[model samples]
Target chain A: MVFKGAEMVIESLRKEKVDTIFAYPGGAVIPIFDVLFDADDINVVLTRHEQAAVHAADAYARTTGKTGVCIVTSGPGATNTVTGLATANFDSVPLVCISGQVPRNMIGNDAFQEADTVGITRPVTKHNYIVTKRENLGKTLREAFHIASTGRPGPVVVDIPKDILYQPLEETYPEDVNLQGYTSPGKGHAGQLKRAVTAVNDAKKPLFFAGGGINVGDSSKIFRNIIEKTGIPVVTSLMGIGALETKNPLNLGMIGMHGTYAANLAVSECDLLFGIGVRFDDRVTMNLEKFAPLAKIIHLDIDPSAIARNVPVEIPIVGDAKIVLEELYPLLDKKDRPAWHKTIKEWKDEAICINAYEGFNAKEDDSSYLMPYQVISTVNRTFPDAIVTTEVGQNQMWTALFWNFKEPRTLITSGGLGTMGYGFPAAIGAAIACKDRRVVAIAGDGSFQMNLQELATAVKCRLPIVIVILNNGYLGMVRQWQQMFNGGRYSSTHLNDRIKADKEDKVSPDGSPDFVKLADAYGAEGCRVRSKSELEDALKKAAALTDVPIIIDCLIEPEANVWPMVSPGAGLDEMVFCIEKEEE
Target chain B: MNHVISLLVENNAGVLARISGLLSGRGYNVESFSSGPTLDPDITRITLVCRGDDTIIDQIKKQLNRLIEVIKVSDLTNKHTIDRQFALLKLLVQPGNRGEIIQLAEVFAAKVMDVGSDTMILELTGSEKKIEDLVQLLDGNIVEIARSGLVSIERGRKHAAVSQK
Candidate 1:
């Protein structure tokens, strides 16, 4: 059958089972949008900004096990997706970004709205292709989707020139793809499996350190079997939260800088650390020198470079996590280390009794305002298993430090790039992917304003995502840095002028926007919570709503900073906890 | 440890740069590399010799396998692999020694691709050692010599797929 490139793209997407696509249209991508108008099978969401479109697609990929797709125009639209692509690359999320490029003849002569989208995204994507011929569209799309979804999945870009999209060709799709050089190892090597099993069985105080790979590989059941049979406690990375149930005796909470005290203590004291599919990111190992100080590490990962890149491993096993775990499980000798389990329980109880929020007694009479921690902990208490997404800065750090994520894939935050304006759209995508569950986005006022227009997208999609804005009036994280290190010289940190005035009039009566009204205007429910009681009540109500998206504007202290942060140049051991007041 | 890998890939733009960039981005060390079109007009052969331990080499092979343009990657370090290199030597042939040079070329089965008034370019295809032997024989009388890097294949009937299996 003869078909145009745009029609072929839409048809190929349908064949690939892609039902929903987040996109933003423009001059270059108009032809594809025109074809999309008649494409009834696919649901295309129009986002306010191109970045939100990519981020929403990324979140969709993370929630569902499908390859998320996003379409955008060239130049600025393609550039905006850079941050989202980087985020997905770092987190290894599967995404296929199809960008409309300027016509082939107009490329490279400084054509209007022409940018080297493939060159720009090369560093952040698993692979990318620029289709110069119309006949290659079907093959390229199939390959892009396959590479994006398979073996350590990541974002892939296909830059389709406008002229190529308009060209006509006889549609021929390859029934099967046989890549000669590309071989993803599907099973574990028997030799490496033997070495790993021997290392695990020989260690007395072994701990399982799992990462997002567990969820991606679908090896949670195998992980549980290994832990139960071996009777070793497991400590997860942020992405590894849901590999095993948090309440299980064998499962310790997340381990790292802001991890539970028990998890950190176990990591520090354990004799053997069995790291599975987890990269030793800086956040997980606060001080690489002192991290797992007493533990002999055994690293198992599919990516061979990651095995010995960060932490030196005693035994490195390069294989798929699921296959490796399955092979390693049977070799372990059945034994119960009751005394070690008891020690872990004691540490957990001590952490809960001492460092937990319930132990903090705020001065009731002061009533200055609610702290960021209080708001985060309240949300954590209300919805324990809700999928939480956060924008960068103080809000992101606070969410990391305060929220208790029980399952893997539930805590979807931009850890590698830490991009601002990621929360709202990502939450929308997550909500759309897992419609049965609630998706909450915790973003700062400054971060929220960057992509606040995505609220219209959320409203149109009826995603039912609850957004919690930590409205601190100013750029809280930067302001705190200035106050602490920059001699209190706050330059461009204040958002007073930015928020107070409307875009049309420079000097409006009220400079600040009523976010509640904005949310209502977008057709979603909105609420303003000032006091602690109001904040708690609003959160409870937002969780109960099942019909539409909800936004809660939370008023917080402007100068509040994320604590227990190691000052940039300082040693990891020299973390600055809450400031201590001097005795008069 | 250093590994010599010979890859067969489709002749396409930016494929070499992609392979090199992937190596450098991951901090892997590439020592020597060369690529040229093979007998097939559509296929190109690339020989890359890299330095690193077994882990690094394994990763390089795996990552190379992921590239769409690459068809096959073989580590010629295995004892069963047969490798060869080709070189052409241009000799300044004196009238008094022309017959002797032609006799030497015939003895080695080297074909004379180009003949000038004073020079004869002999094309010799064989293992790296054989080329080195020919170069040493005509070192003093040779005007110039160009050598193609190593291209390898396993000696046994088994191919990469069969070996891997």
Candidate 2:
């Protein structure tokens, strides 16, 4: 049977078993939108903008293990997705982004709203295709999904011109894909696995350094078992949160720039560093020379290029983390290192006094203003089973440090790109994927505006996401950096520009659009709190919502900073504790 | 150190941009680049001459190999290989200097492609060194020069076939 190009896409999506799509429509995609209007089986959540659409899809795929799908129209709609695609690319999240284009004849003529969608997105996507003819649409889509979901998954773009979408096609979606140059090995070598086992047996101080790849490989349960059986202490990169339970005695908190004292020190002193599905990013290994200097590193990753990109390794195994851990488990010897455990405990104890989270005593602090740590940890302590997402900045670090993520895929943040406006829309996507659990978007005032418009979509879908904006009147992170590293010249870091330097109070005026009123305009619940007690009251009210999202704006201390910060290029050990340490 | 890395990539649009963009982003100096279709319609072979030490070159290879389009990457720096380049020179053909230019072209095995009343275009296909010598021999008389970057092939049976892995 013959079908239009738009119908072909719908049919292909059905074959791929995609139940939900985050989309934004435009002139070039009117036909597709028309079809979608009547297709009750396919749930399309039209977001506020194209960026949110892609981010929502990205988060959906990251948490659900299915390929996330996004559809955007031509020109600006297509360009807005670049940041989301790059974010997905760096982390290897699977996304299939379909973009609308101008008519085939109008391409390259610079017609109205005609931008080169394929060219602009080429570098960001794993692969992209431009469909000039209708006959090849089925096969192209089949290949697009195959490439996106397999072999170290990543985002792919398919650009279809407006005219092509209306034309008739002869074939239905294909059942098979042709990818001659791609392969993903699932098994580790016997010889290499044995060498790793021997290194594990020979070392007195051994450590396990995990990353997001473990979660992507679906081996977290097996990972925890190996850690328990071997009795080795574990440290994870930011992406590796929930690698082991937060309360587990062996799971050292996140490692790197904002990593805990115990994790950094253990890595520095270990004789063996067993790396699983991790590429040592610069943030994780600030001074590459001093990182794991005394250790014989054993690295395992599915991507061959990631094996030896940064640090030297004695044994590099290229295979799936799930399969490799399953194989390595049988060969491992059960041994305990009590001396190493004692040393790590000391490091963990020292870290608590330095980390700012430990310094917060809600009732003891001055009652004039609210503390961010108090609010973040209060929510974490209250909602033990909820999923949390954070924007890039002080809010992200505070959540990562204080949330105590005890389960996998519970904490989502933009780690590689550190994009400011990631939290709100990503929370929407996660909420859609896991309807039974509450997904909270915790963002700072500076980062919240990046995609604040997404509030309307939350109300439309009744996502019931709890959004907490820690309004600190300044870009707190940059301000802290300027104070420490740049001679206290707080230039361009203030979000509240109305604050006069001569004013005695030196406090900026309230944020415009007043978040509470803004949320009210969208028909969603908005609550403002100025004290620690008010915040607690707001939390209780927000948690019981079933039909709408709650936006809670809390007035917070402007100068509060994330502590145990390693200076940009300094080694992991040289962390400068914040003001609480100075008071001592 | 200078190294010539050969890659077999899927013949698709934007594959070239992906490779060049990465090299540029990583600050690797691409001294020369050549790419063209292979006997297989679905694949293209790319040869890049980059300037870097061992660590930098290895980084370039690893990053390039990560691209889905790239099937195989072979470093031909130390391997036995054959390389050739071609250049087209548009030169001022004054009456007195015509014979001197002809003599230099004959020595370099350059073909005389186009000739007008006052201009001549000479095509030379040889090693890069030989092309450099001919250009130096006609330094003042040359008006325009378009040179194809270095293209190479392994000496014997060492081919960069698409590995199944």
Candidate 3:
């Protein structure tokens, strides 16, 4: 049987067991979709924009632990996917995006919808291919999947010209392609791993610093077990949340830029800082030179490039996280760490928020305002099992700082790329991937506007995603930065730029466009709330809805900020909490 | 100190960009770079020179090895190796001094590859010192010169080439 190039795409998708695909059909890709239109084995979701498709696929891959697939046409369709591709690339999410190109002959002629997909996406993708001939389609597509789902999985693009889709073909898909130079070390160097394990056993104040790799490597169970046996305190990078249960005795919350007070302090004072599957990004190591100064470091990462790229480590073990942890577990002589826990608990006591302490209210002074922290903590407690996604800025930092993420892959945020329009579409994708559980997206007004158009797609599919928008009327994170560093001149950060008609000196307190109206316009349920009492009732109502998507826009204090931030150039230990309450 | 890090990598498109990008991204200065295919057409042997202390060099090597297409990387900076550079010089040859130029080229074992009415082009291959001396001898008369960066092989069987065989 001769298969056309389009058939080969479906063949590869089937081979990889990709049941769900996020795609946008265009003129150049009609042929590929035509074949899929009648297929019963695949379920393809049509997103409003190519970018949303990619983000949806990204979240799907992250939550399901599968290689997510997306398809788009040439030119704008392919270009639009850049941000989503970048997000997947930075987080090491396995994704394969198939983009249709103009015919092979018309590629360089500036033909309609033509794009240099491979050239444009090179640096952002793990690997990419331009399929020039009909015969090369099968092998190229197969290799694209292999390369994407391999070690340190990442996004891969396969740009196939239109002419290649239809051909009279005799087939020969290779038994196996020879990818000679590609090999990831499965087992770490025995000597290096042994020395690392020895360091952990010898140190009294050992700290296990886990990162997103725990999820990527499928090693969270082993990591939790080992940490329990070892009695070492644990601190996580933002991406490393859910590496182990946050409630674990050993687990200290996330550490880094907006990390909890105890976590950063523990890292500063620990004797042995064992980092697993994490690149020491700036957010994680606030000031590299002063980070973990007292700790003798042992870094275990599958990506050798990440091992010592930032701060130097004494022992470097390059191997799969699961395999390395399995090997290292046997060598450790588990010991209790009482002194370390006592030190960490003292710091935790200082980190707790008095305002978010169950019943505290911001309504005492200003009856019109609600605190952002209260909304997030309320959502966390109401739907304790929900997978939370947050857009960039205050909403993301607030969720990272306050929410309790107990399991790996439960909290999906754009940690590395910090993409603004990510949370809602990603939440929809997560809902699709894990249909039994609830997926809630906590976003700021500024971020929600960037991808609010995706609300139409969510309602069309009845995704049942609950979106909670903290309508602070400003880009809260940037405004906080401007307030603290720029002499309190709130420049372009405020969302409410409209001047009031009656009051000459006052800016309009009304938040623009009314999020409830925007939600209603998109054909989904919308609720707007102001006082603290109304916040819980709205969230509960939104959470109870099962048939359609729900958007709960909470009117929050414009001056609300993510506290305990490590100023850009400062050390993690140098966090200046915004604790001196400003008079209302 | 300058370190020469050798890498055997897949001849995949974008592999070179990734390796070079990694160095530049990490703020490591690349002093010299030379790359070409090994005996196996599928693999290319890459040699890059970076200047740094021991800590930085170690990071550079580890970074290079982290690239998915990079098969192996080693620091050849301190290893005993045979190294050479190739250079081609085009010089203006006055009628009165043409013989002197030919004699100088002969002494250095440089081949005269082309001769125009007013100029002669000489191709020379040797250690950097020899090329430097030849250029010095042909000073003022030389119009333009192109030099290949340094390439090296370990003195014996300690390099990647012999081990691959």
Candidate 4:
């Protein structure tokens, strides 16, 4: 049957089993939107901004382990998805973003709403295509999904011109299109896996340094099983939070700057650091020279380049983490490393805050203020089974630290890109992807404001996402950095109008909008709390609401810093647990 | 050290831009890059000469391989290979030095493509060292030169694009 290009797009989506898409409309996409209007099979979420649409899709993909889809119009609408695309790209989230372009003939003519979507998104996407021919639409769209959701998955852009959608063509979708160059390696080289297994067996103090790939590759079960079988302790990157249950004795919390004391110390002291599906990022490896200096590294990753790109490895096994781990598991010789476990436990005990410790309240001259950690911990306690999303900076770090993520894909955050304004919209996505589970977003005052407009979308969808805003009244993470390193010069990092007004000694605090009122304006429930009791009460109330989203604004201490910081250039071993007060 | 990487890629639009962009975007230093349609119209062979240490070169190769368009990336640096660069030189042909320039070009096996009243354009294809030596010999008399970077091939039957075949 002859099909309009727009109809073919929908046909491809159905073939891919896509039931929903987050999109924002504009002049270039009117035809596609018109087709979508009657496309009852697909649930279309209209986000206020294009960026939120992509972020929502990204989180949806992360939680559901499916290729998330988003469609936006040309020019500014397409450009707005850049940040979200980069976020997904960095995190290796599978996403197919269909951007409407100007007419094929006017693509380069600077026509109205014209932008080089393919050119602009080239470096940030896994692969991109500009569908010029009507017949190529089916193949291109299907190939876009294939390229996006396969090996080392990432965002792919398919920029289809407006005029192409109007053309009719016979619908013939290829079940699969094989590209000559691309091959997603499944099983690792047997020899390398044997060597890796040998290294693990031989080492006295071996530690599994898992990254987001464990979750992304769906290898968490195998990873945990290997850990269980071998009795080896594990440390995770921020993205690797849920790969192993944080409560497991072998699972030392996150490792790196701001990592649990045990996890960092164990990494520093371990003999074998088996990095599975992880790129040893600079943040994770504070001082590369000193990072795991004593460890013999065995790096296993799906991406061949990732193996030896960051740190030298003794055995580099290139394959999917799940397949490689499965192959290696049979070769592993179980061992009970009591001495290593003893050492790790001792290190864990040495940490200032024990595992599962609630956040400490801020103390200043007998006045107590709510801490960011307390708010996050309170949410963690209230919604123990909820899928938690976090904004960047102190809030993200705090959540990563305190939240007990027992399973993979439970804690969704922009770990790689560290994009602010990510959590609330991501929560909206998580709520949609898993309708049975509650979704909570822990964000900072500044980050919540960045995309608070998404509240309207959440309210409209009747998504019961409890947003816990740690209202510290400042850009807390940057402020912490400025305070520690910039001689207490709190500059542009301050987000509170009251503080800024005091500093300027002129402007009124009236400019700072009340978040509760803002939430009310968006047709969602809103409440503010200052004390611990009030915070719990608000959380309980918000959790009870089945269809309405509620914003809980907790007035946290402005000066709370994420402690145990491995100061930028310092070694992970040289973690400063707490800063000594300087003479004023 | 400098490395010569031979790549066979799908002859698709934006493949070249993707390769060059990967280099510039990742801060890898590309000394020279040249590409053209290969024997198969659907394939393109790109010769890239880049400067990097072993780690950087390894990363450059792996990154290039990571691109979907790139079918094969063979580092011809350590291999026994035939490497040549083509250059077109426009040299000033003053009466006093015209014979000397022609003689130098002859020694280098360069072809005289055109001769103006005061200038001559010579087309030369040789190893980088040979071209450099000739340029040095004809130093001041040369007005301008355009050089195609280095294109290399393996010495024997082992083919880089064998996988495609």
Candidate 5:
């Protein structure tokens, strides 16, 4: 039977078992949307902007372990997704973004909404295709999905011209893809694995350094088992959060610039660093020369290039993390490093004191301001099992540090790109992917406004996402950096309308838009929280709402900074602790 | 260090862009590049000459291998291989200098393809060093030069075939 290119797209998606697509429509994609209008099997989520659509799809892929899908029209619609694609590429999220293009004849003619979609997206995408013929639509789509979801998964784009979608075609979805050049490592080399086991056995202090690849490779459970069998302490990169339960005593918090003092010290002092599914990004390996200086690093990852890229490795095993861990588990011998544990315990205690936040005690101190830590902790407490997403900057750091993520895929954030305004839309995606799980997006005042338009999407879908805006009236992280390095020249970090207001004014007229009112305008519930008690009450109220999104604008400390920060280019051990350090 | 890399890639639209874009985007220096279809119509072979340290070259090869279009990546820098380049030179053939340029071209086995009233276009296919010598021998008389970058292959039965591994 002959079918139109649009039908082939839907059929291809159906064969892939894709149930939802986060998308935005425009001039170039009217025919596809026309077909989607009556399509009941596929749920089309119409986000306000193209960027949000891709971000939502990326988060959806993260939460469900499925290849997320999104469709955007040509030109600006396609370009807007660059940040989202780069975000997914860096974190290795599997996504298929379909972009509508001008007609084949008009593609390079500078016609209306014409774009070099494939060229623009080549670097950010794992691979991309421009379908000039209707006959190749189904096969190209199958290839897109296959490429996106396999072997260190990443985003891929398929650009179909507008005329191609209207033409008739004989369609057949290929059952299997055969890309000779694209092969993923499945098993570790026996020789290298043996050497790694030997290193693990010989070390007095061994550390497990985990990254997002563990989650993307679906090896977290095996990873935790490896840690359990070896009795080794672990520290994670930001994207590696939730790979090991925060409840695990041996699981040191995130290890990076804003990593826990204990985690950073452990990376610095370990005799052997066994990294699984991690590339050792510069953020994690600050001052690479001094990073893990004493460690004989053993690295295992699915991507061959990731090894020895940043830090040198004594043993490099290139393979899928799950398969590698399963093989290594039998070779491992349990160790009892009493002396190393004692040292780590002292560091953990020091970290706890440095990270201590005055949660729910501001009333006793006669302070009316809400702290960022307090707001994050309260939300974490209120929804203990909720899926948490965070916008970049201080909000992200606080959530990464304070949220007790006990399961994999529970904390979703733009770890690699650090894209601002990613959380709310990502929370929307997470909510849609897992309807039973409560989702919360912790955003900053500056970051929240970046994609606040997605509130309409959340409301339309009736997603029970609680967006907690820690409104600090300034670009908190940048302001903190300016305060530290730029001689207190706040510059353009201030977001408040009243520029002359004292920087200390906790409740002074906050910038425009009034978040609560903005939520109301979008038909979502909204409230303001000032003190610790108000935040708790507002969170409780938000938790009860199951059919609509709720915006909680928690007025946090204006000058609050994420502490224990390692200055850029400094060693991980050179952390700038908070003022509350225990009397030297 | 300078290295020559041979790659077998799927003959597809935008394959070249994906490769060159990745190299340039990563700040790897591409000194020279040439690509053409192999014996198989569906496959194209690209040879690129790049300059980098050992670590940088290692990463460049891995990154190239990561591209879906690339079928095989073979670094011929230290391998026993045969390398050749093709060039078309337009030389200024003034009445007096024509014989001197012709003598230099003949020594390099260059073919005198076309001779106009005042210029000579010579076609040469040989090793890069041979081409360099011919250009050096007639440095001032040459008006234009278009040289194909290096194309290299393993010397013996060892081939960058897809099924070899």
Candidate 6:
């Protein structure tokens, strides 16, 4: 059947099995919104900010493995999508951002609310298009979805000028699309498979460094098989968490800065490194020159540019992780390496000991604010396999360091873009996708405000997500930078007085809404915790609830900062550890 | 080892980025790449040259096939392919040697696209090896060469026809 562009978009999404969409309305995108209004099949959430809409969509994409779609208006509306687009792109989350542009005639004339959205989002998106004609909308939408979900999945944008969205066109969605310039590597190269096998056989201390690509490619089975057969110890990047069970004997835990001492130590001493579907981001390879210095690197990724982009590789394989691993599986020899496995096991034991935190002693009756680490560890213990999403800042680092993730896609956070306020919406989305699994959002007070409005969306959708807010009364990350670089001159970091004032009345007389009151207003449960016991009880109760989202406002110390953090513009090896002793 | 790969793909948004992301993500080094629309609006031709051992190239081919948009992938390095590259060289020519340089250009069938008092620009299109040989012949007199990445076609066959279902 022939359909309008807006109707076609909804229809296409329906075909893709999408049920909900998060979006904000605007002038240029009224047509699509109008269509959505009449449509009862797909639910469109009205977000407070355009950015939040896209972020929610990204969260949905990550959790569902289906392309998350967001619709926004022209100019400012489209520009607002940039942050979410960049976040999705960096994290390799599949998203389709449909933006409304000024009519084609007014595009370059600098008309009202006109912006070069295609140009602005070029670097941030996997691919983008400006639909000047209505006829191309169906093909473009179909193609956009395909591109977003394909190899090394990422965000794709389609900029539809207002006129095209409004245009009445007899358009038929192509059952199949053919593109000429794009070729995704599907199978493992036979030669590379042979060489990888040879390298594995020849190596004495071979290690597998895994990354997020493994999850995106659904290579967990293949990865487990390869490791099981080859007896290669595996360490994951922060994004790579959950690829293998952390409890697995062969799993060495996450490696890099803030990584387990065992993982870093093992990588440093290995003779051969087989990196799969993971970029050697600076976070993983602290010192490029010294990283795996003793190892002969065998890099396998679908992207060719990643080969030798950071750490030089002796052999590079450009292919999908799932396919490549499958091909290499049978080629491998089943040789037992008990000595090497034992060595890794010993290192893991030491790591567990080093990372252990001693509980608060009764003798030391210090009534200081709750430690971030204690809060994170307690939550991890309570929800051992829960999908944990984090807002960027000290809380994100705390979650990464404390939560031992044992499944891929279980720890969904904006790693590459480091976007704040991503936790609540992402958690909500994850809760929706994995209905059987519990999802928790660990966010700092400052970061939480960025998308606090999403609490309403969660409540509306009846998504049972537990939000643990590390309310440090300041923008923790920026405040820490100010403390370190700005001579301890706290400019705008103070939030304690304001937080208390807002709590008293729950909303300002000037109509500014308090978060706790807002959560209650939206029919969701809310609690404020001051002690460790209170926080733990709130989390346990929240986890038990499956009808509505819960918000726990945690009163934490503003001075607390994530330790072992590598300061920007500083050497990777140089890290600022948390202070254990008072300054002299 | 260097390998030449010819891929037929659907001309769609993000296809190029997907290809580039896949290559770069895997740690494979792309030596050169060129892509353009074919005679059909739905199809496009992409020729990429990458450096790695045989196993790596094989992996690249396998991965390229997995991409939904990709119709076919052939490792042209060992195959009979009509490989061509375009290079435009601007040269600093003295009045005395201008005739000699023109004679050399005629021998190679290179066209003089631009001429100036002290500079002459020659446009040449040929196989990579042929272009390299031509560059060596005029090495001392050449000022600079701007190359468009290599583009190739399978010899005596079209990729679309073979892959069409």
Candidate no. 4 TM-score: 0.97
The per-model lDDT (C-alpha) reads 0.80, 0.86, 0.84, 0.88, 0.89, 0.79
Docking quality tier of model 5 = high
Query: Candidate 3 chain A: worst 10 consecutive residues by lDDT?
Result: A498-507
Could you give candidate 2's per-residue lDDT for residues A56-127 as a string of tens digits? 998898778899999999999999999999888887889999999999999999988788888888778888
lDDT of 1: 0.80
- Candidate 3 lDDT over A1-584, as tens digits, reads 57787777887788778899999998888889988997789999889989999999999999988999999999999999999999999999999999999988897899988878877787688878888778778888788888888899999999988778765477755547656556666999989977887788999899889999998889999998888777788899888999988777667888888887788888899998999989999998989888999999999988877877789889999899999888878788878778777888777766666334422334444565678767887788888999999999989988987788888999899999999999988997899899999998999889998888898889988888889998877888888888888878988887874224112423355645667777899899988776667777887787778868988888776787776678888888887777444799
DockQ (Cα-based) for each candidate:
0.31, 0.55, 0.49, 0.85, 0.90, 0.13
lDDT of 6 by residue, B44-100 (tens): 789899999866776788667656567778777877777789999999999999999
Tens digits of per-residue lDDT, candidate 5, B1-165, equal: 889999999999899999999998999999899999888899999999999998899999999989999999989999998889999999888888788778878888999999988999999999988999888877888889999999988888877877874
Question: C-alpha displacement of A551 in model 2, angstroms?
Answer: 1.4
User: Which residue ranges in model 6 land beyond 4 Å of their true spot?
Assistant: A168-171, A333-339, A356-366, A478-523, A563-577, A580-583, B1-165
Error of 3 at A31 (Å): 1.7
Q: Name the regions of candidate 2 deviating beyond 4 angstroms.
A: A356-358, A362-366, A497-510, A579-584, B93-97, B114-119, B161-165
The number of the candidate with the highest DockQ is 5
Between candidates 3 and 6, the lDDT winner = 3
- What does candidate 4's lDDT look like per residue over A522-573, in tens digits? 8999898776788878987987899999988777766878877899888888
Candidate 3's C-alpha runs over 4 A off are A172-177, A353-368, A497-511, A579-584, B11-28, B31-37, B50-60, B158-165
TM-score of each candidate structure, all chains considered together: 0.82, 0.95, 0.93, 0.97, 0.97, 0.77
lDDT (tens digit, per residue) of candidate 5 on A1-584: 67788877888888999989999999888888888888899999999999999999999999999999999999999999999999999989999999999998887888988889999999998999999778888888998999999999999999999899899876678898888888888999999998998989889999999888898888998988988888999999998888999879998889888899899999999999988878798888888988998999999888989988888888999999999999989889998999999999999887776666534223434355688777877788899999999999999998998889998899999988899988989999999999999999999989998999999999999998999998878898999898888877999998885223324433346554677778999999998877778777888789889899999988777788887788899999888875333464
Compute the DockQ of candidate 4.
0.85
Docking class of 6: incorrect
lDDT of 1 by residue, B43-127 (tens): 7888887899887787788778667677877788755766667788999988888788888888778888887888999999987
The predicted structure with the larger lDDT, 1 or 2, is 2
Once model 5 is optimally superposed onto the true structure by TM-score, how far is the C-alpha of residue A553 displaced, in angstroms?
0.8
